[model samples]
Target: MAARRKPALICCGAALAAAVVLAAVFTALYFTVLRPRPPRVTATVVGTRVSAFALIPSPALNLTFDVAVAAYNPNRAAFEYGEVVTVVRYHGDAVGEAVVPRGEVGARASAEVRAVVEVDAVEVFSSPYFPLEGIAGALPFETATTVAGKAVVLGVLKIRASSVVTCGVTVYPLRKETTSPQCTSTVHVG
Candidate 1:
């Protein structure tokens, strides 16, 4: 009777150990393989400064801002080559944002790149009625138009540097309201 009891206890202990191991493996899979991926870039705006200038047709609001974006590649995969897009908000209004693609990052590793964003005044109130005048028939400024009072979104930025390049973006925000020739405004970068 004693010997029979010992074998039964041993068998039970082994079964319990196997079950625990299986549970651990499943938990790891759920956290790693089954979990959602983290963002490619951790974005941060160090600082921002705006310089306003008036274009002949409208004023140009140039934004000079310092930005920092970083990421962690655990698998050590080919993530060095990725994209970084940032959206800047000021007074509840977004000034603009930019994205850096993988192609640009892979070219350089562990480097911070500088980006410049521009906001124009004329573009603020730009109207199709006032199609840009071209020497032959090419109106470049037309494409850069923006409605007045509307938030500015600069689109995407692509860059590469040695290891990491941390720089600034000079953005031109155009507002054509003519409310003030100075066209002074506040900008929030993040």
Candidate 2:
């Protein structure tokens, strides 16, 4: 009976060792390759259109801005996002807002979103710094874009994620052009 028990004990030990090794390998792979990553977002000012500008009766300006937004997913999952919201600000006050329709980005792929922001005449003229900047031959504006969505992995696991990108741009109303934008971006996942 002792001899028979020896072989059984050896077999059980070998099985246990194999199980531990397999678990370790799988854990390492999940952390290094299968883990989900946050998507990268960026925005740029593509074009500017100044329709009306006057300071005679009062300060009034009507401007239309064309913006290009890009999103890149680095994971092996598809990212489906809700509407993209973009707000334009002058001296920390919101002057314009635009919305892009909801969309999806494939795994390891990128998408470009276009938005047309219309500036309110009242909001632009309300800023005290507007006169100074206007006289300086350039107007400064800030654009903030927020994207919220979820990443679907293997059509089963869904991870919520969001990204925000803010850009500072200088516009020459007379020239109908915008300078290179300075931008910052952040992403969150849960």
Candidate 3:
């Protein structure tokens, strides 16, 4: 009778141990995978420095606008960004392109990006609505940008994500600044 009782106690202990292990695994999954959160991103035109030029033969105008971009991560885990691409357009013409340097944003942190964009006169003039005569004055422009990256959730799960931002701004090339640009942004997680 004593020997039978010992076997039964050992079997119960083993079952309890297995249950505890399974519970721990489920808790970890819930925190990392099931409840993963996306990072937050923001962009502002802190400074828009512009330089303009005009060709002698062609009526085209060239310009360069240096822009600043910022991103904030509001997650509990670190957000690592891959590549950030920014395209600047005048009217509908693509005038400049920029690739922001990629880096990691610590949990609940922010990152700043610098982009120097060069736009040729031909591209701006190609737009039917672009005022070629008033090339020396303020110009309406649009900036479309994307940031692709991955987030580490709970130090275990890594999720891929992307952030897109489009902005329409009126820039005064002569003043070298933007006049209140309107921006729309979205985040996609996978």
Best by lDDT: 2
Which residue pairs collide, candidate 3? 61-121
The sequence of per-residue lDDT tens digits that candidate 2 reaches over residues 28-134 is 97688667777888888787888776666866677987889899988788888999999999889999999999999999999999999999878777788878877
Question: Which residue segments of model 3 deviate by more than 4 Å?
Answer: 1-29, 32-35, 53-62, 132-138, 174-177
User: Could you give me the TM-score of model 3 versus the true structure?
Assistant: 0.75
Q: Lowest summed-lDDT stretch of 10 residues in model 2?
A: 51-60
Candidate 1 local lDDT, 1-190, one digit each (tens): 9999999999999999999999999779756643322213333445545555444574344544445554432222222343544444332234455555544222113444444444332443253422332212212220011111111112222112122222232222342111111111222222
Residues 38-81 of candidate 3 have per-residue lDDT tens digits of 76766655456555534346554445655566777767678899
User: Using Cα atoms with residue i matched to residue i, what is each candidate's TM-score against the true structure?
Assistant: 0.34, 0.84, 0.75
Clashing pairs in 2: none
Candidate 2 wrongly placed segments (more than 4 Å): 1-11, 155-159
Between prediction 2 and prediction 3, which has the larger TM-score? 2
* Candidate 2 whole-model C-alpha lDDT, 0 to 1: 0.86
Predicted structure 2, TM vs. truth: 0.84
lDDT of each: 0.36, 0.86, 0.74
